[model samples]
Target: MKTKFSFLTLLFIVSSFVIAQDIQELKIDSKVNDVTVFLDGAQVTRKKTVDVPTGITNIVFVNLSPYIDSKSIQVKVKGKVMVQSVSQQRNYMNNQPDLAEAEKLHAEIFELRKQLKLAQTYLTITRKELDFLNDNRIISGRNNELSITNLKETSAFYGERLKALKLKEIKQEDDINQLEKKIQQLENQRNQLSDNRGFPTGEIVIKIESKTNSKSEFELSYLVTNAGWFPSYDIRAKNISEPVEILYKANVHQDTKVDWENVKIRFSSSDPNVSGVMPSLNPYYISYNYRPSNYGRIISEVSGFIYDNKGEPLPGASVSVEGTTIGTVADINGHYSLMLPAGSNRLKISFIGYSSKTVDANQPLINIALNESAQELGEVSFRDVEATSISDALQGRIAGLDISRSRNKKNIADKESIAVPFVQTENQTTVEFEISVPYSLKSDKKTYAVEMVDYSLPANYQYFCIPKVDKDAFLLANITDWSKYNFLEGEANIFFEETYIGKTILDVRNAGDTLQVSLGRDKNVVVQRELLKDKTSRQFIGTKKEVSRAWEINVKNNKSQKISMVILDQVPVSKNEEIEIEIKDLSGAKMNNDTGELKWEFELNPAKEKTFNLNYLVKYPKSRTLYIE
Candidate 1:
């Protein structure tokens, strides 16, 4: 019986040892192979190949971004292995790598502090020595009688010693001041660098079960924050006779704390952060509206970007309405929006190291640049204000503004040489551009411009002018079938006739079948509007008033070729039944009765000019005052 018990014990021990050996923990390194960057976040795909033994195993992937969403974790294993479960956890032990420049600056600041301390100590000691010399300066007359030569020598020694100590004290103080300034500069630099570092990493652990020992390939993917892309464009037109060439590009940025080296990039217009489920409509209940009323009309909101003199975004800048408490701060992207009270027409902008500026708030979009200030101000604290949503701020708020994406085109003659580096794919609700070449994107917050594609489309160009509003003529290009090119609303750099003109916004979201793009002001086309003083008159007839006004507008085409031009002018419409307005002469112009706007279209040859006349008469009660311009 004793021998049988010993054999069973030995068998049990061997089986337990084999089971423990089969289940092993393996740490594997993975490389970021592909990245799909969205408008708000990015999806990272990593791959690795490894050999595994039979049985259960835990594969650990380390050094990932701590901002990764755990629920988005996905693991796939190819070969004879079956993925049992995948999990992720924060790895505080493995922090992000320290920035080399920041570390060097820190060392330099430490050394400078030590030198400043020494200089301060030396200055204090020198001052003490000067005091000691002054206290003993009376020794010559008080203690004993001395020869004239001895008295002169002692006086000279004291004068020379005091002067030397004073100079030394001045030198030490200067040195200390310089060291402090140097330390401050270095600290600022270090602070900027340190902002991008010290984030803890993450680790993903996958449990796998394999039937037989074999080589396995694994793919892991997850969504990470602090990464996104925005679109920008370049619109070029060599001349009015040719088509407009549009260059589409994207500004990609990421701060995932992991460098994406030689990885394939795909820009997706879809925002995975937004919910995919369709919204359901609830039953509506009717109710009476009761609200307080203000006297003047109030602008709902105003939104725009705040930039520094160098065109860089000034985040955390303060923007407030003049003479009111309504205000908000810029976001991390330098975007701000404020709700204006009644009759607020000016905006006050301020920053710590930049000069404050006050600008007119008459427009919906107000972008301002603040210059750097010589004197630094104390830190300003901002309240945590909830920003208005993009949809809420844009819907029916900004007239004629739309959002979409677009592609660019090179010159028509160089169409063969133009190589598109991306393939466009359309999904149900979004579009994606898959880049062909691999990209190496570092873990920095700076933007990388990625050129997508170029396009040259047929356009109808015409010159448009509103002489009453602006004397300069603006060139407009009407592009038919613009919807085929997926376009997003963004800032566009405009170039006409081989010269860089300026910048404009390309908004196609609210466009119809035809898209009209402004090519900026053309100085060659001169326009002048004059009011005829002899035709202006006002008279009263027994509590009734009659006013007559006449204006003349002249347009001259100075270009070497014939051009099409459209001129626009407006007349005031009566708001009260007691007032009446009549147009005597519009110079054969088309008029909109509802808006009282006149439009004239014509073609002019080089060095040719055209003139138009507008005459109007207004009749109103003489008791009420009326203003017209």
Candidate 2:
């Protein structure tokens, strides 16, 4: 504020501006520490050259802060050189705003203190009056009537006191509101005053100044278009970046004056070199190259299906691929095109809010149908069960043999329902099934038409189900019908493929241990006394010579325990002739070919009894070569 030219000096300056080109007045007001130039009010930029007339023009100045907008400032000066040489300093005391808010709050608190004083006085008087009534001194008129009069007086005092308290509270609230408004005003002021000081963002303001002979005119065509974005917001990891494309679905017009109909106009992103529009129908694919910078062209595609766990298709269910930029609403048929990648090698499919699933899509087609996971029931298969018996109790488990029959109620019926009969081996392993009548309809003494569809099955299992009837046709018809298998109750023995857990197995002899045994093509082996559901599953592809079918233990206390053992066997018939076992252990064991079992007892002081394992080779014709894949 030190430098100033008198009004008389300004008259001299006016005379000095003899030509219109002379700048008669020059002034500057700045909110930043230094200001050597001026920019457009909204632009916040410095122009290369600003034509000035021979006079003092009221050029407004502004402050700069990151959080504030520019505000106008006023100053007075007298010469071009003075204006050019002058650097105005600008400052804003941000802390002073809190001072304003504090002042308002202080005033509000003062008013509140006055109201609180009045309220306190009222409350004191009310309490004193209530105490007087409690002493019954305020009684009058009749007994009850006097009591009512005292209550009336007490209530009136209390009501007045409460109202006064409420009024004081309301005043406090008003004070808080005033403080809030003051704080808000301070914020607004700060925001209104901030600017970048001097920096350039990508926002461009093109003020078109046209000269029709000396008549200079200007117009603005503001464009806030993105300079770095490729416009395509859809990109999947599997998609390679090309010139990413975006479709402006909204209707676009040229200008306010005219409406263009069906104009096939194109819009460019940052660079005019890259541009695209919606493709016309039936055009050959044109190759578009992408210019790579820090950002890559984002692109995408999506495939999947929705289904319920019951093998039923869920219609119109939403399915999505996680982490994939591509998405599609499921079709009316409940199928979705998750054309995200060529395929998500690790395909994760999900419905709305349901648990998502990840499955490997290693097939030619990667469309996966999702099913809700289910909890299985507690039950098992009986054929997979070792028949309960004393012999069953002592059997270490059997390898394989012809048969030693056990007691079972075999019933004859009008129609013979065929089934495979199962028996346990010495190890308590439910192994073999003698298929005397591979398929037969039979009724038990109780008239129960029961039939075991499988001739053999696994030993250790957690759950099992079987068709009531053994007819293959009926079984196939009811495969998914839910009524085929009457699931037997009880934890299964052969519970897992190679290991069993979370399930109980009555492995009287640790038969619950997963038996991963490989059977030779024509070897007769007793697998399990009762099978899981399919005894054929107990069979395996042998990469090594099969375990010897027969094992023997010397009954000398170390080896023998004449434990009552029931053995089951299986013989792959290469010849039409019957297969028999040649035993060398204890003589008490009996063999029954019809049932494919061997059972007996031998005495052992841990000595006289001996245990043995048996194996046999099946002979076939030279021309009868079996081919297996």
After superposing candidate 1 on the true structure, give the runs of residues whose Cα lies further than 4 Å from its correct spot.
1-23, 96-108, 118-178, 185-197, 275-420
What is each predicted model's overall lDDT from 0 to 1?
0.76, 0.29
Q: Which candidate is the best by TM-score?
A: 1
Top candidate on lDDT is 1
Q: Write the per-residue lDDT of candidate 1 for residues 1-629, one digit (tens) a residue.
A: 99999999999999999977877899887899988887766889898988988889989888887767766666666688777677776675665446576678878999999998888898899999999999998855656789899989989999999999999888888898899999989987776665555556778888788888899887777778767766667899999999999987776667778988878777777667557788998866666794443446445468999998889887767665554323456777889876555556688786644677889777788888999864311211111113232211112221221223343433212231223367666655666777666657777545555667778989999999999989999999999988767776555789999899976767666579999998999999999999999999999988889999999999999999899999999998987999999888899999998898999999999999999999999999999899988
lDDT of 2 by residue, 1-629 (tens): 22355766777777777644432332322211111110000111121123344333323232222111112212222223122221222233321235455566556656656665665566566566556545664435455554667788877876786576566656655665665566556554544333111111111111111122122111111111100111111111111111211111101111111111211112111121222465575644545685433332222333445665655454434333333322233454556543333323344444421355666544434455655542212211111112342222233445643433333434323333322243322223223222232122111111112233321221211111111111010000001211111121111222111232121211122112232111111111111222122211112223312211233322222322222222323323223433223333333445665653544333334334344443433332333443211
In candidate 2 the C-alpha lDDT for residue 458 amounts to: 19
Per-model TM values vs. the true structure: 0.69, 0.18
Give each model's clash number: 13, 71
